[model samples]
Target: MSPVIETNGLVKRYGRFTAVDHVNLSVEKGEVFGLLGPNGSGKTTTILLLLGLTEPTEGEVRVNGLDPLRQPLAVKSRVGYLPDQVGFYDAMTARENLAYTARLAGLRGTDAAGRIITALSRVRLADVADKRVGTFSRGMRQRLGLAEVILKNADIAILDEPTGGLDPQATQELLELIGSLAHEGMTIVLSSHLLSMVQAVCHRVALFNRGRIGLTGRVSDLTSAVLGGAYEVEVEASGADVPAVLGGAEHVTGIAVAGPGLWRVDADADVRPQIARRIVEAGGALKNMSIRRTTLDEVYVRYFQETKNQQEKKDAEAA
Candidate 1:
């Protein structure tokens, strides 16, 4: 099947500064795709281009096989967007706010009323459907925004910073809701800078850096590609020579001192047995040892660190 969204050599520039530079992306249908990056990294710019809110200086974009630039209305009809700061009439009830949205989308009467109730129930706000939106918390507002999307019966949902400023409980609830959406066959495009949050909900992610995509793939794939391993072992041992001894163990790709007696070891496989034996041979008292799959946070940090190092090398050579 063709991608639900595709962009080729997408670029946007203001003056001499490019906001999005030569980005090529493809998002499949029914999957949650994440645009991961810090602020000013061009994630929002790319979204605007996709939505036809802004025209790209150069490149091609197709949203569900239609050109967003030339067919914006058609694209808007099928796409729902929830901005970082979701807006609503504070005095209006939850159902009232969604009813207003439904009218704007040309929905009314029984059709609109049924959708309002169903959307509210899907987002778990059915009981509070009549409560004023002004009394709703930040998390509640976010879910309400999502309800608006569901009410539209949109094929694609683009959420910008959906969980930003949400507390732990709220974030978890929102993430679960997002997962359920994808499970029910809605294509979701999530944009956020929180590495761990993106890892929790996104099936695949594109890491943005300085108007460019540094890497794009499944989190586990990126972890192995960037860190040179998929397994990370945390070793807590006491001895002056422990680091040196562990560094030489087979299958160990890299090791970093995490704390006074804690070292994070990156390896290709589960080398806990080898690591344990090495610590004993070196006479290091092992306090603790644990292993788990490498996380996106580590992959993100290591990928950018490598990019910085390469740029520095080229600058030194130029000098």
Candidate 2:
């Protein structure tokens, strides 16, 4: 099946500066696709290009089989966007904001009213519907922004750091909304710095850095392969040279000194009992051992650190 959103070697430039450089993406229908990147890594630029907010400088782009560049209005009509910093009239009430956006989204008369009420209710903003946006907290405003987007009943939603300033409760609510939308087969593309949140919500994810895609794959497969379900075992000993001993162990992949008299060894698989016996036989006292799954944050840091090192090496070579 053709992808819901596809970009081949997409590039975007502003004057002499390139914002998105030869980035590629593919998102399936109903899938929650994520762009994971730090600030200024071109996540927003890529979104803009995909949503027809900005023209790409190079390569082909398509959104749901339509050329967004040629039919921007068509794309925008079916797409909803919630920017990182949403702009709204501070004096307007939540109801008022949603009502206005709903009308502008092409809903009319009774349809607009129904959409406004449904959206506000979905975000639990009905009680605060009459409250002025200026007085609303950051989390409240984030909820309002979410309401505004769905009011249009868009097919594709593009959210840039959608959970910014939201508390745990609000973030969870937003995540649930995304999952609900996906269950209805709504295509979603979002950029997030929240690794755990994305890992929980997104079916497909891409790691972006320096205007390029560093990695893209199914979140489960990506993480499982990276982790290999390894366990960490720490031992205490005096000058036992744990690394040397573990280096000879067939199942041990890595060993490092974590602290004075503490050694951390990475096992290929969970073999805590075997490792304990080996340590005792080698005269190394087993202080503590714990199994830890490699979290999304750990994977992100590892990959992004590699990206930064490579970029630094390029800069050094240029110099």
Best TM-score goes to which candidate?
A: 1
The number of the candidate with the highest lDDT is 1
TM-score of every candidate: 0.92, 0.89
Counting only residues 3 or more apart in sequence or on different chains, how many pairs clash (N, Cα, C under 3 Å) in candidate 2?
0
- lDDT by residue for model 1 (1-319), tens: 7799999999999999999999999999998999998899999999999999999999999999999989988999899999887988999999999999999888989999999999999999999999999999999999999999999999999999999999999999999999998899999999998998889889899999999999999988898889989999999988746668976778888898898899999998999999898988888788899999977887888899999999999999999
What is the C-alpha lDDT profile of model 2 across 1-319, one tens digit per residue? Answer: 6688999999998999888999989998888999998889899999989888888999878998898999988988888898887877898888887778876777788888877888888888888788889898877777777787778788899999988778898889888887887888888998998888898899889988778887898775555445433455666666356676566776676677889878776665766777677777878777676766556776678677776788899999999
Candidate 1 residues lying further than 4 Å off, grouped into runs, are 236-250, 257-263, 281-287
Which residue runs of candidate 2 sit more than 4 Å off their true CA positions? 224-239, 248-252, 310-319
State the local distance difference test value for candidate 2. 0.81
Report residue 197 deviation for candidate 2 (angstroms): 2.7
